[model samples]
Target: MQRSDLLYGLIDLFESFWQMAVPLSAQGEPTDDAGPDPTQETRQLLTYLSGGLTDGAIARELGVSERTVARRITRLQEVLGARTRFQLGIQATRHGWI
Candidate 1:
């Protein structure tokens, strides 16, 4: 075969192998549609909180006020049903957020 044909055949073989190696999971398994939005403050807050940052620090990093950070954290706790930052961290970890 020509060199171009050989490369095309190799590409097809790799595509087949990739398709076989990554099968979809079972249906109705709980997917990750509940996590915080990537472009939102809640996700950033979770990241900072998990990284052991203070609320003031997170506020500064996010370019928002400390009170806003506190309020966002409070809302996040309510959404996750977490009573404390530790609990929020655990939940976020379990949800693959941090």
Candidate 2:
């Protein structure tokens, strides 16, 4: 399949998994804010995640310290209600925030 097809398929799979795994209201609520208006930094962070980079790699790319990267990632996790990096990716993809 094409890369686009694969990407969409993966998104679909994640959406389905979330729909089945989480309650309707619980699935919609993110811990940080109600709306999904991510900042430029957050967007860049998501782009880095899409590239499958580690926090260290992302910090290097953004010219920041790993501690800063970790802080941002922690905030992102709360904002997206994702317990892990993998779940963050899936949730971000599903919400069209990535």
lDDT of 1: 0.70
Q: Write the per-residue lDDT of candidate 2 for residues 15-56, one digit (tens) a residue.
A: 988765522345544434436578887888989988989879
TM-score of each: 0.58, 0.62
Model 1 ranges with Cα > 4 A deviation = 1-40
Local accuracy by lDDT, each model: 0.70, 0.75
Q: Give me candidate 2's TM-score against the actual structure.
A: 0.62
* Model 1 backbone overlap count: 0
Candidate 2 residue runs with Cα over 4 Å from true position: 1-33
Quote the positional error of residue 75 for candidate 1 in Å: 0.4
For candidate 2, give the lDDT of residue 87.
Answer: 72
Q: State the displacement of the C-alpha of residue 12, model 2, in Å, after optimal TM-score superposition.
A: 29
TM-score of 1: 0.58
Displacement of residue 88 (Cα, Å) in model 1 is 0.4
Q: What is the alpha-carbon RMSD of candidate 1 to the true structure? A: 13.0
Report the C-alpha lDDT of model 1 over 1-98, residue by residue, as the tens digit. Answer: 44798889999999987764412234533233445444556677888988889989998999999999899888766665567788666656555566
